[model samples]
Target chain A: MANILGTNIISSLGFTTEENFQTVKSGISGVKHYDAGTFGLPEAFMASLIDKEKLNDSFSELSIKNSYTGLEKAAILSVFDANKQANIDLSSGKVLFIFSSTKGNVHLLENAVSEQVCLWYSAKQISRFFGNRNTPVVVSNACISGACAQIAAIRALESRKYDNAIVVGADFLSKFIISGFQSFKALSPELCKPFDKDRKGLNLGEAAATVIFGKQNNSRIQLKRGAIRNDANHISAPSRTGEGSYRALKNILQNIDKGQIAFINAHGTATPYNDAMETQAIVRAGLADVPVNSLKAFFGHTLGAAGVLESIILMKALYGNLVLKSLNFSKQNFENKINISTENHFSDKKYFIKLLSGFGGINAALLFEKR
Target chain B: MNFKNSAELTELYRSLQIYYPKFFKMDNLSKLGFLAAEHIFNACTDLQSAPDCTPITSRREPVEPREDIAVICFNRSASLDIDTQYQKTIQDNDNYFPSPSLFVYTLPNIAAGEIAIRNKFLGETSFYVTEEFDAGQMVETVENAFSDTSINAVLLAWIECFERKVEVFMCLVDRNSKKSCIFTEENLKYLAINIKFA
Candidate 1:
């Protein structure tokens, strides 16, 4: 069994995981409408952005400022803070680092600097910052990248090839990414409302989150099941039936009991198809009534970071017996009868599942339990 | 092996007898992966008689849909072709239209998805971007994939493409194998750099 030793979040709300989670539990949204002129678009869009000035200050306090890109700075600072929390010797060879992001250092293309924008180059630099000797594995599999990384970390620890692994997922918004969503009309001009009848679309956010997985050490949380599958339905949109997500959910549910599941953290991107697909998958997996929450309204579909960031919140929720509300949700839009948590509830549940489906017809599900 | 280097990607696609027209739509990264994985399936099926058969095009060797197999790939440049294309649309003032087609391939794992679709692999797929084709790291990563207990086979690949520099390497890891190439870094390096995978 691989224990979740530590977790951290660096988002628009605050630096630490506690700050981000508590602020969201209170129902304060960081997403705000920004003028199109901010990014040279024709219309305004809502996004949750990290304060650049504050980020620079935090970086300098930890390591150095202006030496790394905003992307690298965020990644480094998250891992640094997480390492301090876990008290793990990152410099040792017994540790593995897996960085998950759809885009890493690709924003550098905006400037004329022309630095190498390769994912491996950035991964090497980031892993070396923590003195990790083994080559870092960089996963760039669309938004499910974080789920994929966690599964890898669990597998690595279980394989006995490494004693511990740090799985981090991060993505910073760029005009290129924003425009892609705009092209697809996927971005909601207002805060996204997940699983609601009036939901418009998803809102993108910037964040970097780290989760440390260690060998059995009496840790309270453990990663139990991880499964990734493709829809083979469509490149950008799967069939409305949620075939891939169902397969992933079913694969994870094979060894898990329905009663033991405390709650489910779903990837409710709030788009027309994404949420419908997830709810359908949940019902198909026979988890229609189990409490479900989507943190995208709080963190704004943080892309790659959504899986780990939201999982960390669920971990804390399981620990504190707090089932946070699915923010911005009012009515049910999905045909499946899922109990989307609209109000905060308290319970001592042992198990939780995280389900995430992304672009490229990919779906990933992870099962975790609180000891 | 019909294709030796990444430069032969275009010619390699032409040489293969695959019916999937989507092969023409993918970026160079996806093309490299589809073709490299094609080579591995060709070997696994032992389709030596299917003259110059790439994995995707060769139908002589019928293999069942194996959920036991996992896909793990490594590369330095993740989707540079599509990245360059998407960046081109946004970087300049005149040619600023972020085509969703190009934007979709911006992440490197789309290649893995293409292969999974063609092969019907429902297992876990991981795209690892590394500084280089470090065999030790690849070996370790492959072993970790097998630790899941349910995974008995793995489609290990190092399909890298950047600025016309193509280095496609794929190895099929069988958990029950007792051969000399028992999923080791040295053996991966050997198959990656020298000789066609038998």
Candidate 2:
């Protein structure tokens, strides 16, 4: 377990964690419709894409422009803002940087697949951007990468080998990603309605989020426990029984009381299979009565950033005694009896669970508690 | 079982006579890792058994479905080999025909998934992409996996397939075993270096 030092999120909704939280709290969505001619795609789509102009303006404020890619810029901006609040020395080898993304510098593939397309190289560049001396760890495990990277940081901090760990998860929309999702027929043409009766597929979004973990003496927030498990069922499809996700939740929830959990922040991507499968896992884990919410309707699925970004928002809500709503959830389509609401609620609970599932039949759970 | 490039992995699979048809659908990186795991798991049959037990050389014996073995793999390229192929399908708008079959293999962890699907071992599987093969990180990662207490063994691997060349060094680390050589950074480096030369 480690202390929650600082956090930041740069997305289409806003720039800082608080800003993005407030935006979602106000029930404002960032999803926009794009025609086939827009963004060089072959079909109409909808996603929460960060404004290139706003990102450039925010990044230009740094005043030291070495010309990094879009993904790199987002990552640097997030890390810089989060470290500013954490007040840690990044140059020290005791501080490790973990970058999580499904694809890094993937846009470079439009020209050729050079060394620049390597995820590790982009991780190194992001690490060196702050003079971090230790080797950066890259987690590219599809959608669960952000949470998996946090678990990595937790393990590293628990080992006492690092004084602090800065985990940043970032990914941007690209023709490569869009076309692939198009091939899978996984894009929603309108704003996604997660867990609703008429819910279609997921919409891709762009964002970069950071969560700093440190072993401090008087830390208020603690990462209680986390687990990652594989279903060993299929590569691209989720398990029919939600085996991996259930195992992950069961492992992390061991010895913990279900009464203290304020809510379960689910990876509700709005896709038919993902939503149904997630509800199955939630109910199977005995969290059927817990208030669950999905932020996909607000920000779309941010891929790697979804885990960390959503965790930050939920943690903030936990501190504020607020249980945010799962926007666009109209009717219960799935058979699971999991609790989901369209309006916000109040809770004085001290603990929350962040759950995510992704490709490769992998599922991850992170438990956070207010100390 | 040494080959100069990844293209010969199909030949290696054929020569080994492993009858898994899904093997052909995997990308080169997954094929390299899948073949290496096939070799390692075949050599040591009783991974969960006592350390003093003799190693079995069974060809097609069905293995038990264990949930304590984790697949912790490291790679340098991180599926760039397949990413490049996926890129070609969508490079030109007029010629865009992105194949979902090819896009599914773009992740490095899918290789671990392929291994897990075949063995039915579902503990904790993760994939880390390092700039290079660092023995210290490998040893640390294996130790970290063991920290979960439920993970009794790890299928540790350093699978790198890029530029048509493949280099894989996979070993099984059983927490309950003491009869074999010790697991250390130096020993891991030695094995990794030897495999590159082999």
Candidate 3:
């Protein structure tokens, strides 16, 4: 098990994890509708976009001379805040940095195409920002990138390859993404209602979240287990039976008591296929009665940042003895037995599972326990 | 079987008689990786028969969806070739017709997905980006994937395709293989740099 030393999130709701958590607990959503021509898209849509001016001001406060891209700035800001809380020496050779993003510096391709457009270059530049000695590992497995990176950190820590790891997941909204989703007809014109019968589709959002993991720490949160599996079904569509998700859940839930699990944090992008698939997986895993919640309504499916950002929020909620409701969820859409709440409640459990499924038919599950 | 460009890859696919018409829909990057993986899978199971008689598309063996093999690929250009293509579709508002066909292949891991779908591989599928191909890193990643007892074999590769240049070097390493050459940093480096066929 690896200990979670610190966490931070930079999203539309706020700039830190605590702020975002509070905003979520109060049932505030960051998703807002934008008219045509917003972000260079031709149609109107809803998304939770970060304020560029606020981000610039906050990034400038660091007094860094180098001009980093918007995605890099958010990532650095997030890692800076998280490392400040952890107080760990990132420059140490024993520390590893893992950067997770579906697209990094991809917007640069619009006008300029250089070595800087490479994801590895962006990761290396981000690691260099903190004077890290080790080269950063970049994970680009679509939406599962964040969860895969965290799983990599867990294994690295367990294997004693690095004493500590700073994993940051960040992705931004662009015409490239917005247009793609629009073409797929996957964008909902209204606020995304995850797990609700009336749910249409998902809304895009941008955010950067950091999670610091250490092998030796006094932290109470421990990343106990993780598993990644593929359905081998379809690249762009989820499996009808949720085979990969069920196998992932089965792998991590091995030999563990089910009662300790406080709740299941689902991907719940509110896309019809995605929500239905996840429900099938949960039921197949025999955890149908466990209370589940999806943060998409509040975060608007923050792409790569969804895993780390949502994991941090669920960790805090689990430790606080609270179960945050799945916002905007009114009724169950799938014919499975999934216990979803639209109202907050109390839970004294200590364990929680964070599940994420993405393109490429990949599904990942991470089990975290608070001691 | 080293291909220098996409044109040569198409020629290679046509000559190999890979009857899977879905191969036509894949982007250049996916086609390169898919072709490389087909070569490796064929080489392993002795399915590479005469071009005209054997129209091998999918795995000929009747095997269940095996979760024992993992596909881990490293590349310098993470789907930038397709990214640029998708970019052109939405370059301007008047010409803005974002094609979902091109957009879905934007992520690099989709190449691995194509391979998994073709082979029915339910194992872990991951794609990593590095500045350049590093044999040491490739060996390390292969070793890391083995930490999970579920992965019995790993299909490790360094598939790079940016613009006109395309290169793919894939090898399947069975954990229980009693082959002459054991998997090592030196062997991996040598094999990646120099293409030697048995």
TM-score of each: 0.92, 0.96, 0.95
TM-score, predicted candidate 2 vs. hidden true structure: 0.96
What does candidate 1's lDDT look like per residue over A1-371, in tens digits?
57988889999888889999889889888888889766666557899888889989888898753667887888888988887778989889999888888887777777642545777677767888887877788888889989998988887877777898988888898887888888888989789999889889999999999998898577888888788877755668864778778888888888677988889999998998888889889998999989998998888978888888889888888988888899998898555679989898997978899999887778999998887
For candidate 2, the iRMS in Å is 0.8
Q: What is the model-wide C-alpha lDDT for candidate 3? A: 0.86
List pairs with backbone clashes in candidate 3.
none
User: What is the DockQ score, from 0 to 1, of model 1?
Assistant: 0.54
Model 3 over residues B1-198: C-alpha lDDT tens digits? Answer: 566666777898997775788888898888988888877777665322222222234466554687777899889999998999899999889888899889999989999988988888888999999877777667767777777777778888778887766677888876653133488878877776676321
Q: Tell me which of candidates 2 and 3 scores higher on DockQ.
A: 2
Docking class of 1: medium
TM-score of chain A of 3: 0.98
- How closely does chain A match the true chain A in each prediction, as TM-score? 0.97, 0.98, 0.98
* Superior candidate under lDDT, 2 versus 3: 3
- List residue ranges in candidate 3 displaced over 4 A: B1-7, B46-58, B177-181, B195-198
Against the native complex, each candidate's DockQ, computed on alpha carbons, is 0.54, 0.80, 0.71
Worst 10 residues of 1 chain B by lDDT: B47-56
Best by lDDT: 3
Question: Model 2: per-residue lDDT, tens digit, B108-170?
Answer: 899988888888877888999997888888888787777776777889888888775667888
